[model samples]
Target chain A: MGVEGVEPHYQIVVTRDGSLDNIEVQVEVSEQIFSDEVKSLEKLGKRLQTEIKDLLGISCRIKLVEPKTIQRSEGKAKRVIDNRKI
Target chain B: MKVKQIAIFLENKSGRLADISHTLAANAINIRALSLADTADFGILRLVVSETEKAQQVLKSAGFTVGITEVLAVEVPDKPGALDLVLQVVSKAGLNVEYMYAFTRKSGETGMLLFRFDDQERAIKAFQDAGCKLLSDEEVHAL
Candidate 1:
């Protein structure tokens, strides 16, 4: 997490379409999290995808979302949402 | 002098920019100048508005990711090579211009260039030493 000014809130939504399964990680970000020298959203997504693949041994997709875009649960924060069909 | 600018993170979807403008208009936020940088998936909208705090609050309340940054506003003469002269000064000082945009006043003979530099303090010092006309926050808002 060397990237500066990145909000810690995120939501991982897992979805499957017929035979295709995908794990999408949506991260809340700000302007400081990116710059002209550093990479763009696509590069950040690729990096996150690699990290997730290494940690969980599965491929996933990364989505950079606006701050506070993810819902905050009142009772307990739900970090992961599974929308995959069995 | 340094001017406060607002940077908003917007998803590259249809009507997203319109939504932001509509929200600001409803709140009476006057955008003095603006620049939009985009990629395949997202866009960063940099705006110099008359009311910085109000614009930030309204945009945030409207569910837009907004950030405030201090940028340098330089008044360039309305003539050819005016910007080039300024750039030469910046280049000689070894300053990097991260991004910049220009806007002209309706009744003025000088145009303003909004710049986001990598090293803001150093850029300010360089401009001052080079005798560049830097606009203050009040002057920018007044324009």
Candidate 2:
């Protein structure tokens, strides 16, 4: 298994009645997940949506937000979400 | 007039549905109305249950990706176009239904419908305006 750790996805769907209207599915990752050129989560959202549609045959709107703040201490770095307020 | 439904993404594999059932059973949650949305590689388990909070916790703790959704428990006579009627409303509203499945009831006079739209909140409002009965969280829990 290519178990390179796991990233958690919190999918929020804004549906009217039982029909899907606009979907906002997001995944939150630590700061390190945002590499050098990837400045925003929009890229991730597009990637996931395409993947989902290809897999499910249902198109959905998605939003991914990865706010990674961390300081390397001991053996691991703790990513924080505090940077979004500014 | 609305029911709280939980949709859990299930990997398509042997015993997947049974696993969900066992997990819910372990927590003493009883299912009321349920339907399944499926693709080739995966499936979504839409369940209306007696205990939402407990069921939510059970599913999350089990590491199954889940979502809380609003679904229409519309009833129709066991006849053709009964389903088409709902579809018509959805189409009229310019809403694209991602998926839907039909269910038969124990009474044998009615067929229960479960569906998902692009926008759930609007879909609910539209159906209610059109006089479709929506099951609430309490109503689903009681059953």
Candidate 3:
């Protein structure tokens, strides 16, 4: 989510499978302005996955979505979508 | 010369590409050349259109995330070993090619190759020194 002059939109989707909990980070990255020269979208996803693991101590999957694809709440932003309850 | 290429972000859902093409067609934008690089979840569609600015504007208005990138358009002879000659120059110059795609004209002995280099300035210089013919934005649009 390293975009300049524009706010990066993202949403965290948490789910559970049997006994393990999984987290998925969806980031909006359309422009080719990555400082590290990430050529492909897959490589950018991998880099963001590594960063999220380092910061949260929980390995998660990265999903690169189009800008503004994530829904925005009116008052309080609902950044995390918990699908584990379902 | 540098050519303006439109890069679009697309989801991996079906009919997304069709939607983009339909949008462009409805707006009278002609896609001259294009390439798609994708992951499991998303894809980047790079296109050289007849009108870069108009295409970008229309695509954005149509709700597609679009960005314009400057890529080198080299004219390569339409024969064996021609591509190798250009690659040789890039290799000798220590230039890193991020991605490249080829497109041919209906009636021409030379095909066009669009290259996105890590170092644009160095790549341009290398191609120029190697006596390669680069297409300008106007040339690409006309094609």
Candidate with the larger TM-score of 2 and 3: 3
Worst 10 residues of 2 chain B by lDDT: B35-44
Candidate 3 Cα outliers beyond 4 Å, as residue runs: A1-8, A30-51
Report the alpha-carbon TM-score of model 2 versus the true structure.
Answer: 0.57
lDDT of residue A19 for candidate 1? 93
**Tens digit of lDDT per residue, candidate 3, span B75-110?**
988888878999999999999898899977744588
Every model: Cα RMSD to truth: 3.8, 13.8, 2.9
Q: Could you tell me how far off, in angstroms, the CA of residue B48 lies in candidate 3 after the best superposition?
A: 0.3
* lDDT digits (tens) for residues B11-126 of candidate 2: 55688689789999998898877777554444557787888778978977775666676655676777778788887888888987765666776455777777666687888888
The residue-by-residue lDDT of candidate 1 on B91-130, one tens digit each, is 9999988889998775348889988888999999999999
A1-82 per-residue lDDT for model 2 (tens digits): 1112225434344544344355545454433333211222335445667777888777766543322211235764332222
Worst 10 residues of 3 chain B by lDDT: B103-112
Among residues 3 or more apart in sequence or in different chains, the pairs in candidate 1 whose N, CA or C atoms overlap within 3 Å are none
Off by over 4 Å in 2: A1-86
Candidate 3 lDDT, A6-76, residue by residue in tens: 33668899999998889998887654432212355566677777766777777998887766778888988
CA lDDT, candidate 1, residue B29: 86
